[model samples]
Target: MISGEQRVDPELTTVIESVVGGTPCANSGEFHYSLAERRWEWSDDLARMFGYEPGTVRPTTELLLSHQHPDDRATGEAVIHRVEDGEPFCGRHRIIDTADRVREVIVIGDYESDDQGTVVGTTGFYIDLTDALEEERNDALDNVLPETIAARAPIEQAKGILALIYGLNSEQAFAVLKWRSQHTNTKLRALAARLVEEARQFDPNSPGARTRFDHVLLTVHELVDPAADAS
Candidate 1:
């Protein structure tokens, strides 16, 4: 069932787990595959991400494919083929965990090769985006109440503002806002409320409000895109 052989890199796993720990999304893991042996290796976090006990199961491409949501299997196989061809892989897919819960995930990886330029393996990280995906879907559903729409209007506006200012897509913008909410020990809605309120009071021509707004912008940028700051 394994599309190809893969193996886990312990050092890479440790590094990735450490990196993910400080992010807004903690449900993520690192994976490696060995093309020569047709084997797979998974980090403990990756194993648990798929609802498996760490080291309890021998990882394989087939096993990973089996956990994918039925409709995503073809895309998943296509990703594997790309990896085998020594190309970088980036895709969003759905996985049915052992608990039978369908989780949305984003996987990003690159090939590993030797001096001869032969692709030996691939490595990457999978991050769970189920909560965000569900929220977006719920917002789009027609069954929502009028009051619910009214309540979400300000938050959606705030998200748009963040997206525009930060050059982020809607989901990443919301994630940045959510991360700020948690880091500051504020309720998500309450924090969003403040964002809206602050913008409401802004006087575009006044340097004072602009300076204050700049502070908020800097704080959000720091949290949401620390990698950018690092560079």
Candidate 2:
């Protein structure tokens, strides 16, 4: 029945008495939609992940929704509606914090009941996902092995040039280039595939002979801005 911007609930200072003495309150908000009287508390780590101030967040349901990605709005609302229907709920969404930076989160809640065990409320938790997201992304990046080592961008373009010039698969071309680097104890991407192309251009019978004489110039062109290459 919270039809507008009005909030009428117990002051957070009262019910959180257990931690009131020495608890470092960062950013927190209490919600009382019906009979549930609960306050959500976040640690300093959580606040940092959401980019919020330690003492200045109002922490309303609307604020949480505002942080969601536009595409996720309906899904998030549907989840909330389902939770209000008395089902145990777990959901993940993006949220913007006090600093206006976006963050990922998983919200979990269950039925709250009175002493008689009658269900009276539902309380939820917001767990920051910045660390988890970064870890997952890094893990995916790690799976690429050598391509990941070279940051993919440079190596992809370098692979394209090699595939075109040597009539070899990109993987095979990269492997040959890698073998050369390992034999010479040099960074694989340092010379890029242009060096290999130079070797291909002349002296096909020589082990390390190259003729392009401008490996540096071609490498610069291939490795710079792989994104624009897609364009």
| Candidate 2 residue-wise lDDT, 138-193, digit = tens | 44334434553465454555555444333334443354344334333355555464
**CA deviation > 4 Å runs, candidate 2:** 1-50, 83-86, 137-231
Please list the C-alpha lDDT of all candidates, in the order they appear.
0.60, 0.44
Best by lDDT: 1
lDDT of 1 by residue, 1-231 (tens): 122333443444443444355454447777777777766677677788888887689976678778978998876776767656656655667899999999877665666767796778877677676765555444433232343346667567667655444333455556555544543445566566567666666665675553465455424322333332233
Highest TM-score: give the candidate number: 1
RMSD of 1: 13.1
lDDT score of residue 184 within candidate 1 = 42
Error of 1 at 36 (Å): 1.2
Give the TM-score (vs. native) of candidate 2: 0.38
